[model samples]
Target: MNLISCAALAAALCISVHAAAAAPVKIVAAENFYADVARQIGGAHVQVTSILNNPDQDPHLFEASPSVGRALTHAKIVVYNGADYDPWMDKLLSASKASDRRTIVTGQLAHKQSGDNPHLWYDPSVMPLVAKELATTLEASDPPNAQDYAKNLQSFLAALKPIDARIKAIKAKYASTPVTATEPVFGYMAKALGLDMRNEHFQLSVMNDTEPSASDTAAFESDLRNHAVKLFIYNSQASDGAATRMLALAKQSGVPVLGVTETAPAGKSFQRWMLNELAAVEKALAH
Candidate 1:
């Protein structure tokens, strides 16, 4: 090729490379599941960061810092579990207001209020709304790659089909099964599976970080001791003293225990994480 033609091609290649690198949308999620979902929807066009990403730790105990504040301020789009689930995220957003920032609250999409269950990720319908909102926000952020974002959203939705079918299958197989928990972390999924989840007062008390009433505690203990429930679903991440005691009692009673979580486990996609947890419940129920 002629020298002039070679130089022109090299310059064009550099511009193309720079444009490709700049196409990604900056996104931040308060929790990892939402980040995973956003990543599924945004695909190669979005760069995502999650603040509460430790699957081994309780997200409710997250301590915010200056770095978190900077992340919120710098992100073009941010997602958080609202209804007081991550009030710190709200505080960060309030403090880090920007003209083009888009904030998505998963709880609000699920129509949750302050006193309502904050574990909205367990609800089947939450992420669909989140994915839609995220795609719209991402399209606006990177108009040149809007079609890619839309296509990724469709792909993510299609991928969820098997997970949804599995959930239905489990619900059908274990409809109206008796169960109990230390907290309401898996309450939505339990309801979907048609479980007669007992000890609401105790679960709510634990979730609200308060002491369960004597009657509530007695009922929980009685249920565990007598095998009144077939399964005990515990939040392994939030195992406080009461939860630890309940876990021991449940194990002693021979009722199978299923551990659920607020964060996605290490090396799991959001869909895979949920399916695995449901499979655990299924395995426990099969006995």
Candidate 2:
């Protein structure tokens, strides 16, 4: 009874240990774009969940649900756009205190703070930083797969070269070209491209869902009406009457309008999404 029973028990324990070690790391990102980055770097080694994935929904309006909290409870790694962009993530993390969990705040990595422009993913420098940090986190968490994580991270960084080149070319050709946006969703990218962005007060008001002062509204309209801004960008995901009116006015005045979303669309990787947006900007500026 003793010899056969001991051998079978040891074999079962060995199999259990291997299965546990082979389980994929779980990651939860507050936004889908970050999840996409996690997927790129993690590949098959991680399972990622993105809270704000719907392109049609406004991320600013996101409220965390119970399921999100449950996901956070099981997540080994968490990523979120900080600087108050997705404050709900902070609340959820605090509620579920796990000492082993690692949280990567993209805004903090970008040296952004509260009251600063929170649309940080649009910053060309931010995502590369995020990718590196994500790879490092994965390596530290799963040393057995460190080499694969490093390779994926390298590929992810290399993919950004075209995006960087696009930004450089645009900046060289269109530096200081006047542009205006209904919201600051693309503010960082616009800054990278060296475009002159106008109507800050109005954009902040719209982003915060506050009423823009009458004078600020008038100035925004005047810019569009007079073709003062070379390009007019509106937050396509979230809009109000003021934004809608400005969009129509831009069309009336023959100003080129570009729509940028706070969240990336589905079926596109982070790299592809950025490239597409950059291409659109280049197209609009050419016309």
Candidate 3:
């Protein structure tokens, strides 16, 4: 082989290495929760992006913009809650026709079909599964950094162990404790903590953003007046007039209120925000 041929081969190899190192794996997360998990598992190898980050807006009613479509079109992997919660992503994915892109749907992970609750992230068991799946998918997409991806997944799972332990402790401490909420957003977490929830009708109605019937409202008011629930979990994102009224009634009855956010609020890390919310619930129960 000539010297020039050897130099050309070396340059090509260097170019290939540089390309692999410079190219970031693009990930599109339909919700903020998935975005957080993706970041934890992907670390510096993946660029995780989320469409829904507004704590004040209802995720169910989210409308996709041109930028979202473009993101979906270019994403190497996508994560979404599939129980008709982020149906906009479904439409965008279908329209974009990116068959090669890997997609993970949390509802499918839970074996739930349409109309089922889409808030799967609140379940303590879901995050590890999602992280593992994400790591696997990222490994498949970018084989050059498979070891890094695995290491990140292991670190994230290790960190999550204590969070799960904390949840179990709360459950043991508050077994069968009575709680109430304006919406079913926190039902999974509450159930995991073994908190018995009252005012289901009001929760479901508010969750669907439909007006509660007169009888349902009256029943919820009676429950509040009678102090039927020890703690009131208020959804800060979509608090309707009914929820506001319920909050007032809970205050009058001396029931402690724990405010919950549907999305990670401004200036808070995902795990910190969740821990803070759970701590608030614990405080309310303690009081």
* Candidate number with greatest lDDT: 2
Clashing pairs in 2: none
TM-score of each: 0.92, 0.96, 0.93
Better of 2 and 3 by lDDT: 2
Alpha-carbon deviation at 190 in model 1, angstroms = 0.5
Across 1-287, the per-residue lDDT of candidate 3 in tens digits comes to 99999999999999999987768899999888789889888888889889999988866667889999999888999998888777777789989988789999888888877766667778887877788999999999888889989999898888877667778889999989888889888988999999998878878888777888899888888877888878888887775888888888888888888888778886666677778878888887888
Off-target runs (Cα >4 Å) in candidate 3 are 1-13
- Expressed as tens digits, the lDDT of each residue in 182-287 for candidate 2 is 9899999999999999999999998888889999999998898888999999988886878888899999999999998888899899989999999999999999
After superposing all C-alphas onto the true structure, candidate 2 shows an RMSD in angstroms of: 1.3
Best by TM-score: 2
**What's the true lDDT of residue 76 in model 3?**
92
Global lDDT of model 1: 0.88
Question: Which 10-residue window in model 1 sums to the lowest lDDT?
Answer: 17-26
Task: Give every collision pair in model 3.
Answer: none
Ranking by lDDT: 2, 1, 3
